[model samples]
Target chain A: MSSYIALFGNPNTGKTSLFNNLTGSYEYVGNWSGVTVEKKVGILRQHGVPIVDLPGIYSLQPLSRDEGVATDFLLTEPCSAIVNIVDASQLRRNLHLTVQLLEFGKPLIVALNMVDVAEKRGVKVDAEKLSRCIGAPVVPVIARTGKGTKELVRAILSLSEQSGEREHVAIDYGQDVEAAVQKISEQLPDDLLASKRWLALQFLEGNERIHAYLQTYMDIAPLVAVRDEAQQALGRPLAEHIYDARDKWIVHAIETSTVIFQQKPLTLTEKIDAVVTNKYLGLPIFLTFMYIMFMLTFDWLGSPLADLLDQFFSGPLTEWLSKLLTLVGASPFIQALVLDGIVSGVGGVLVFVPQIFILFFFISLLEDSGYMARVAMVMDRFMEAIGLNGKAFIPMIIGFGCNVPGVMAARTIEQPKERLLTILLLPFMSCSARLPVYALFAGTFFAKNQAIVVFSLYVLGIVVALGLAKLFSSTLLKNESSIFVIELPPYRMPQALTLWRSTWDKGKGFVRKAGTFIFGGSVAIWLLTYVGPKGIGVSMDDSFLAVIGGVLAPILAPLGFGTWQAGASLITGFLAKEVVVSTMNIIYHAKDMDLLQGAITQHFTPLSALSFMVFVLLYIPCLATVATIRKEAGSRKWTLISIGCALTIAYTISFLIYEGGKLFGY
Target chain B: MVLTDLRQGQKAVITNLAITNEVVKQRLLHMGMHEGEKVCVKCVMPFGGPVMVEVDGQYICLRRKEAACIGVR
Candidate 1:
């Protein structure tokens, strides 16, 4: 069995970067907080010991779901030693968590990261003196460059070899707090003997999570009484009293060891923020950033790569397979299944890969450069109408490119309620996948003003998403007590290597999902179209796909596009939104877009065409999006709600559009 | 004075948090914001957006509703 080391720290303190350094692994690192939302394990190569990198948190008291992950690991997990990463530039605030870790009574080694940044800002720390003050070995490190990592690794191996138990640090608070600590310590159970002092301190500070954990082992009536009495004794909050005592001890340590040259604080960050967050310039700046990212991802870089991929699959790969089948004397049925069903089915899903990676690269850049926090702050005012803060806005914007990445990007939101709300509302963002359907319909129905029609659909998606968010946040998801607060980290230029690694990390999920879920969904749709009860390779009108479409067509009658051909196209659309157009092309026996558009004009009027597009816009999300939602949401319940909500809203809205058009004599 | 009442470049020492919710109070405390922490308003966004404040060399954004609960002077 291998011994394990627990890596912990305050959020955005370079904990993940240090973990990446020690373990020789590349996990995502972001400037803003809450980027690592789950615990990850990597091996220390030299020693082969497991290092568990827990989510970054300020203290044992969790403010959000990710913070709870760190706090739970601290209380429950057993480790040989604890590696606490403290940001050197923000020493005072980082030390607040370090103080709590000291009282945790584990063998501790503090990795003082970002020393170079601290030095440039005129802040210096004497590692040995600070170590003596905190009763731990402090290794000054720069995680970004792997500087001092060798010594840090050596210190970690030595720290783990030492005895795991140590005397917990007991700071002498004012008389009132100390009195209450003594009484609460007496009331703790025997099982919590070693941690009684720390538990009592946390209990007095109103850490409800710790209080509830203690409740299972002992009756907490007396502990509660002590806390109330202590709060009454101190005219101010008891936590402040405790903090003040720790600050006094820290001040002495800082005065003795640390030196400050009194340079202006964060001049670069302050200057950049002044203009980026200006009253008039903030929003326009953010919008410009978003537009640049979209253009790069969709037009400048990603589009050419995707087009090349499309040509390879349809032009070369399909022809090569056909030649091979002909030379081998294979049956025509086998040729159709191989070329049309498998080749085209899989290729269609693969075409989106470039866009996903390019979009993820830009997202990683935003998160790493520390501009994400500012984006949230700038958008919070507009998002307030939906009862959400600005963090929820990031995922929705990303959804405009692809919903799979959009759903995965919701992890940055700290609170679970906001994250879930963002995920549920993602389908209505009018992703690039739905654009083909809009192009086919809008080109035929509203040829004179194609841009306006497409833009109107995009605006409708946003308006409905916002309206539903406002409804759900106040009703079903109203339980969270979260406050709107954002921590603005200093902007740093993202390194090329880090940007690539994180982009790969995020983009890989979308690819894997496409490979498994989308692949299977395409095969299933193809199978239904290829065979019917009448016989194998029967016409699609008499096939099982058509039967299913007929079942759905009646329900869609009120929405004005009630034919089985419309229904069949929608059934295949579930596999991927792009498949709907292809399915219509095949079922309607139209070999090209002009033929399809000519045929569609004969089957429906302009009003029905618009309603059909609306139905496609708000119907259930594609299968890959559903699968990603299930994995990210972590519950079967929310995934169903997302699907059901989309289906219901799509139906109601499309029906209104079609019927109201008739009532107004359109 | 409440925190939101401070203009740009105005500094204030946090006095008492007039919040009834204990969890929100704990969050504020854990951010190194307590009774005596000095904070300077870096910028106040228009249309009642979040106000960016610099405290102890750290910048944080606090919305108007939560900022108003911070008793400062």
Candidate 2:
């Protein structure tokens, strides 16, 4: 049988990095909590034993959705061993979870990650002493540089090879609590993987999941009675008492096993935080960085490469394909399907690959360097003013890449009301899928100010999202503000390997979507345009698509660009935002085979194009996003509210832009 | 005094967590802000924004209102 070992740790302790080092899989590793929201499994590179990378969590008793995932897996999965990774520098807090894992009685190995970082701060850990104290093997490793990982894996394999039964440590929860736990342990089911003592402790700490799990086997009334008695005896919530006991145990273990010289003073992270989190200069500095990122995406780096790709696709590639097809005596339909349907459609979106990669590159850099948590800190006041917590900003930043994970990332927020509001407002963040539309329009019409125009659209998205957040928080989702406590992880130079991995991970999604959804969508649109009420190979103006687009055109007339082609693109855009560009490429190229940029310029002036971009910005999120909102919000009503709200906002704003432009005689 | 009242670089030990919300209390406690733990005021943002505090080698940022609920001496 293939043995399963889980890599577990508190957040920001390089758990994912170590998993990557072990499995040779490139999962994203950010220096913050809640980065891995789901459990990822990979086979170890050498031993081939499957390793699961679980989300970083504080304790087995989960407090958030991601934490719940970790705890749930531990309670249920029959893992051979648990690799409890801990940050050597923050051993005090990180080991709180470690102590709880030890209670589960699994064959456990401690990976003392970030030991170099600890040593730089004058802290030295005796790994053997720690192992002896905790009754588990401890391996010191730096996960980021892959240092000492071989020994760590060898330790895991050795531990797994041992006899299945290993000793489980039980923390003494004092006299009163221990007696109460003993009473509760007798009532636990006999078949549980975890010890009944651990279950009894979790019951006393009010872990509902444990109670619910035990409910299936036996009545939980006796368990509840024992828990309440313990709470009363302890004269406080049992969770606090249990944590206090565990904390003392951890402090004792550290004191006996580790030594600290004089502490190293805070260095670069502090000096930078002094300015980056400054009251006066913080927001401006943030805005400056955003501006530079956009300028680089649109003007400096991405656009020039995109233009060269566009030229190659529309010029040489098309000519070569057409000549080859004609020489092979291919039919006109096949020629059109290959050239117009597939090449033009998928090519339109694929040309923006450089821009998408660049945007993700910058985001990964900010995330890996630990600057994003400070951004949340600096924006807390602004967020609170709008009745949301600062941590809500993290999901919105994630939403800028895609709304599916963004909605899921809201699981980190403790409060239900705030999480829902974050989910509802995330669609307006102008995800990377919409980048091609902005690039197409800005490159065609607003060429002189391409960077600024694109930058303005992103800013507008945030402004509109904030407005809606204010509206929702005060009206439909009113609740007390959740606490804002986030760790500002020490900054480190971003690893180039990690950065490239994340950039490729996000950028590859776009290419994959183009090949699948956009490819299928373009072929369908081509067939619809080719076959009409009259016959096949008719003018597109008289085809089935024209009739469909004609019916939808008038509804969008007030928003400018009320043509059937625009209407058709908007309709297909519901599937995915990138498909909007693909739909346009097929529809426009069907008539005369014109370049997409030139075709867009002919149909839209600068003002109308700007309005269209704003429409795309605020419109309904894609189908995947809608389903995610429905699932995460766990209510069909809120899902409808999201779609309804987005449509209303998009229509109203686009109407104002178009009508206002016409009134000003633009 | 409450945590927000501490001046920059001032050290104090948390005496009581006055907040009643279970989730918020647990979050703070998990960050090593339990009673009797030592804390230092790192930075206080302008205009009554959040306060940054260092506790157990971890820097945590808390809103001013939340900071006021953390009793220290």
Candidate 3:
């Protein structure tokens, strides 16, 4: 029989890294999951057994959706054995879960992960002593280096056969609570999964799960009434007092066994965090960092690469295609459809791959370097200022790269209301995918002030996000103050392997999304224009798409953008942000240099082009983002509200930019 | 002192958690805020709102109403 072991731990404890080391596979690693807050399990093939990595969580208790999955799997399924991964440096905090698992009475192997980190921090742990205390086989392993992991697995296999009856090591609570636990245990069924003592303690503490369990399983009203009376007589809620007493006992145990010197010299991470997370300077530093990031995205790196790509695809590729068509004797309609619709549409959008890579690369570097945590800290105060919870800032920061991942990051926030609010506002943060459309217009029309134009749009995204967050928090979601307590992992020089892996992962996602959605959309746009009515062969300026664009033009005329080119991009942007640039390519016959140059000068004024860029910047996210929002929010109402609000905001901002610029005689 | 009575920036050593539930107890332990840990009040929401307290160099914010239920000394 093959054995299956599930590895579990808290966030930022190197759980994923450990799994990757053990499995030799690159699973997505983040401070939080990118989808419905559930454990993403990836199986590792061992010699004869399989290892599953569970999501990192603080406890088996279901505080969030991820935790719930971990809790459910452990209780319901009978795994051959379990490995509890612990951050050796943070053992005191990590041990709490170890104690909880002890109650389960399953065969557990302790993987003392990051032992090197603990040693570096001058914290020495006696794994032998710890194992004896917890009645488990403890292996002091440095998971990053794969040290002691094989031994740890061997220990788990050895213990798998000895699981029937183990000594129950009861935690010391005070007499009254212990007495209440004893009374409650007598009333519970023998076959119940949890410890009778624990369940009784839960009942005394007025635990919601226990109450529901009791109500459903047994006619325990009388017993609960008696327990309540006993709790009242004790002059306290039974649960609170017991937990407090247990805490004191655990502290004593740790103090007796675990030696700690708190007065250690400040580490290098602290030196950096002190300056960056400074109460006075943090906000300014955060803004400066963000400004630099936006500037670099457009000016420093993105511009040169984008220009080169544009030249290659637009200048050379288009000219070559036109010459080829002339030789092949292809009809004008077919040539236009093939060159303008397919090549210009899809190929044009793809030319901005440089900008997408730049954005995701920087984000990946920040995340790997641990600067993202500091960003979260700086933004927490500002988020609180806007009446948003601190936990909600992470998803919004993530939204700067991509709304799909941003919406998925909402799982960590815990509170349903706050999670929904974060999802609704995520699309408003300028995603990197939106950069191509901005690059096209700003590169063409606002070349003199490209950086400023790009920077202003990013600022606009923030303003719109904050506004939407405020609106949602105030009306749709009540003022629920969800607490934020995030762990600050010590900063290290980001591992080069990790950074490269992350950057490549994000870049690959961009390429994949382009290939799947943008490629298909581009081909569809090509067919539409190529096969349209009359011998005119779907002139982009007079095609069915243009007619629809014209119909929507008047409503947006005040925004100084009634052009079919701008209107058509907005329509395709609803499919995917990448498609916006491609859609413009199709309409403008961008692959044909003469047609591309002529179409831009004849059809679009600089102000209308600016309006168009602003519109794309603030417009609705791709359909995937909408579907994710609907799934995560668990209601169509919030999703619909998000879409409606995004469109309205996009229109309003474009209107201001276009009309305001024209009024100022730009 | 119970958490409800602790003022902002005041330090209190948790003598008792006062919540008897095993899950809650496990969570408090997991958070490193179990008994004997010294916690300093960081910020209290306006109008006796959710209280933010720092324990073991980490801050945890909870509603004042929930704090009132926890027994701390």
Candidate 4:
């Protein structure tokens, strides 16, 4: 039989690093669970031994979904040995879980992880002494460096093979609680012995799940009555007292076995946090960081790459396809269908791929570099001020990169109501794909104040998001205050490979969406316009979509973009936000424009362009985001609430901007 | 008073929890934060947002509003 080992530790304890070094896989390394809803699995190597890195959790006492998964696996799985990875720098807290695991009575090998960080901070641990006290071999390891991993593996292999009766370290819970647990355990079924202590504690805590579990498999009514009496006599929660005693015992043991001073060297994260988390300077620093990122995105990378792709696809690809159709003697109607509808519509959306990649690449860098958590911390206060939870900031930040993942990532928020609200409001954030449309307008009309105009549009997006979040929280989704507990990961120099992998994954996702939805949507939009009542073609600009858009045009007149072009763009944008840019391109013959001729200037007026950009920025999120809302909200009603609210807000804001500018004689 | 209102390093035993939501109640129970747990308030972040508390030998951070629901004596 193959030996099995389990990797366990608190969240952000570099357990994943150790797992990665041992296993050699590059899975997503998020500081926080992008969502707290799922359990993830990964394998590690140890000479024919299977090692499983359980999800990073605080203790064996399960709370969140991931925590529940970890605790359930450890308590029930047939693991030959447990590799308890303790964060060396934060020993006291890390050891809490270690101590809890110790009570499980498995063959334990302690990995004192982050020894390098601990030593730098002037905190020292006597691994030898610690080994003696816990009756487990303690090995100092820097998981991030893969140092001491071979020894850790060897220790696990030897421990797993040892078949002696395991000794459980009794945490001296107070006499009364211990008496109650002993009585309860004697009444429990034999099957509950694996986690007898945890089960005992759960019974004392009045856990209904344990009661149901016991009732299903064993006779336990007598046990429950006795546990209820014990609880009543205590006049308090037994889990709390048991936990207190357990923690005290562990703290005392750690103090006796380890040496620490009040003073420790400042960690790199500490030094960085001092400025980045500063109350006064923090927002400005964040703004400056975003400024540099966006400036580089547009001026350095996005514009050139976008121009190159636009030339390649429109100039070469389109010409080749058209020539092929001409040579093949294809019907003019079919030629127009493939060329004008499919090529023009889909090709327009695909050309902005360069800009989307540039945006997501920067976002991936921020996430990998550990700066995103700080951004969350900084944004938390303001989010809280508006009666929203801090965790909302993370998904909203992801929304700026792309709303699909942002919507998916909302699962991390423990409160369902808050999670739904965040998802519904997330689409209001100006996603990266929206940036191209904004850029096209700002480049064309407000070229003199391009950066400022782009910045203002982003601000408008945020303002609308906040207002909607507050509105939804106050009116429709007012359920309860959300549970907000987030871990801030220490700053580390992001590995290049990790950054590249994330960038590649997100870039690939963009290309995939372009091929599927964007391709299909463009063709659909083209057929609606081209295949009209008239023979192969009347003016498509006078088709059914055009007439409906014309009717809606008057509604947008106040925003200085009353044209069917802008109206039709908004209608197609419901398919995908990137379609807004493509809709503009197809409607305006953007593919035919000469790049050297200052295209933006020749195309759109300043006021109409600004209004069009703002409308795109503020309008309804795509159909996919709406579907996510329906699924997460579990109701068509709230989904309708979200749509209605978003559309109203978008129209109101755009109207204010357009009407206000005209009133001031713009 | 809420955990955030505690002076730095003050220790208190949770007497009651005002959690009305079942999800939060289940989460609190899972973290060993049932009523009567002895929780020592560690340093609060510079702002009155996420308050760090040492509960059941575990140092976990929670938002102030969440902590407010945990009654301490």
Instruction: Summarize candidate 1's per-residue lDDT along A1-666 as a digit string, tens digits.
Output: 554698888888898999999999988788887777789999997778899998888887886767777777766766678899998887887887888878877788899999999999998899999988887899999999899999999998877776756656567787999899899888777765236778888888877778788888888888888898988989877777788888888777677778898666887787899899998999999877766765665556765676677677767777888999999999987787666665655565566578668777887888889888898889888887677778787677668767886787687576678888888899999876676677678767886665567667877998999999999999998988545677789999799988998888877765675577556655666678788989888887788888888998898899998988899889878877867765665555543445567889988799999999998999999998999999989999999998999999999999999999999998
Q: What is the TM-score of chain A alone in each candidate?
A: 0.86, 0.96, 0.88, 0.81
TM-score of 3: 0.85
What are the per-model DockQ values? 0.73, 0.75, 0.21, 0.23
Q: What lDDT does candidate 4 reach at residue A304? A: 73
Candidate 2 local distance difference test against the native: 0.87
Q: Model 3 in CAPRI terms: which quality? A: incorrect
What lDDT does each candidate get?
0.80, 0.87, 0.70, 0.71
Q: Which residue window of length 10 is worst by lDDT in model 3 chain A? A: A30-39
Q: Model 4, B16-63: lDDT tens per residue? A: 778766666555554556566788775455566566565644445566
Residues A197-269, model 4: lDDT tens digits: 7677766665555555567777787877777777677777665676577667766767777777544534565
True contacts kept of each: 0.81, 0.71, 0.17, 0.29
Error of 2 at A469 (Å): 1.4
What alpha-carbon RMSD in Å does predicted model 4 have with respect to the real structure? Answer: 5.8
Worst 10 residues of 4 chain A by lDDT: A592-601
Task: Compute the lDDT of residue A318 as modeled in candidate 4.
Answer: 84
For each candidate, give its TM-score against the true structure: 0.87, 0.97, 0.85, 0.78
